[model samples]
Target: MLLITGITGHTGGYFLKELINNKYEGAIRCIVRNTSNTSSIDNSRLNIEKVVGDLDDPEFINRIMVGVHTVMHIYNIHHSPMIVQAAIENKINRAILVHTTGIYSKFKYASEGYKIIEGKISELIKNPKCPTSITILRPTMIYGDLCDRNMSKFIKMVDKLRIMPVINGGRSLIQPVNARDLGVALFTVLMSQKETTGKVYDLSGEKPIKMIDVFKIITKELNLKTIYISVPLSIGVSLARILKILTLGKIDSIERVQRMGEDRSYSHNNATIDFGYNPMSFEKGIKIEVQEYLKKNRN
Candidate 1:
């Protein structure tokens, strides 16, 4: 049996599609929140079961972990420790956690949170009482289709404003991985469980591109004449802070502005060497996303 979480999310939704396309015959179970919409995933022909509950509940976690041989957790990192504990109790053979590459960011709060979660997973794995092999995959900024928050938001902003801000000349290098490619990477790692057990891999795009170029690609795809204005990092951060306060924390924060100025490129060599992880180029992925965004908005 295969157990999965975050099936309603972007990457998780794509992962479920990949499994259904490949005609996976295993008894698949998905844990989702009551408010999550499962319309995107086609569970018609598959032997699938849905467990609607909260991750914080121990009884709910234990109930879904029953008879699950492999657990693919793609939800929030905060609930990872609880899920890992439940998996261990259920004697699951393997657990694949989909974490973020933001853990490597210069931002203190983001990095520390991921580090703590990673630490908890490590501690559980080392426990002699628990023998479930764990594989952690840290993906770069994941963007694909209209469901994503990264490039899709950029497209929307450029479409409306026609003038987008570029901090520090937008030279910060970023490797934005497509959600479909991430789904493929997750499936590949699961199939190569024997070699990937107790491993951590960084899943990134085919190559790194400047943030300005990313915005350019989006503009080109949308056929929108958007002007990119370069701003000093310090100035942008300060303005973001003020806007955040004025908006009552509804707007972007200083930390996010700082992150925009920092390079977030990561190497996918380890994932490639282990499971043949080859993602599409940024331009191609962004084009697909732009089209999806336009189509949805047009409807």
Candidate 2:
């Protein structure tokens, strides 16, 4: 049996579709939050057992690990240590874990817990007694659907306000992979377990675009006339500091603002050479996404 976590989520939903397309015959089990909506999986034709629980609970994880040979933990990267521990303890031989490209962030606050978790997972993998072979797939900013919270929010803001506040002259580079493309890459890695085992792949979009170009594309796709206001990086960080205090640390985005000046692009040549990974260009993917958003808003 194959165990999956977060199959009801955005990327997970697409990954499940890929599995269905490939005609995977394995018995699948998914761990969903108590409040999770499983209508998509429950209504699907795949043989899936829905296990209600939290990844935070080792007891629940251990219980679900039974009869499971492969694990796909896609819910959260912070929850990886426990999942990897459980995979090691349960003697599961093969697993695919989704982490993030934020692990490479230069900002301390942003990369906090990332290195520690990656290190812990690495140590677990190094254990001579460990039986699990783990593969880590890191994806850059994921933007496809409306719920993505990255590009869609930008689109909505551009539509509503017609003004975009960009920091650092909006020159920093970002590569955002479409959820559908990332899903296909996930399935490719799953099928090539022998080649992908113990390897890390960066599943990024086709290419990197400047932060300003991102907003430009959004304005064009949404057919909105927008004004771009460029704020200096220092000023942006100061505003974030004030917002952080005003929100009682709830909106603490000082590091996020600071990191905006840094480039976030990565090469995915390895993923391409290994898994035949081919991703759609941002304009093509975002056009379809924008159309969906426009249609829904019209309805």
Q: In model 2, what lDDT does residue 214 have? A: 88
Off by over 4 Å in 2: none
Give the lowest summed-lDDT range of ten residues in model 2.
155-164
Model 2: number of backbone collisions: 0
Candidate 2 per-residue lDDT, tens place, 1-299, comes to 99999898999999999988887888999988878888888777888999888788899899999999999989999889899898889999888999999989998877877889999899888977779999999999998999797889877887888667899789999999999998899888988998788899998999999999988898899888899999999999999999999999899788878989999999999999888999999999899889999999967
lDDT of model 2 at position 177: 97
Clashes per candidate, residues 3 or more apart or on different chains: 0, 0
Clashing pairs in 2: none
TM-scores of all candidate predictions against the true structure: 0.95, 0.97
Give the runs in model 1 whose Cα sits over 4 Å from its true position. Answer: 40-42
lDDT of 1 by residue, 1-299 (tens): 99998988889978887887787888889887778887665444788888789898989999898899999999877888888999998899989999989999878976999898889888887877686888889999999888788887788888887777899989999999999999888888877888899899999999999999988888888887988899999999899889999999898678888999889999999988888999999988888888888887866
Considering summed lDDT, which 10 consecutive residues are worst modelled in model 1? 38-47
Question: Alpha-carbon error at 227 in model 1, in Å?
Answer: 2.2
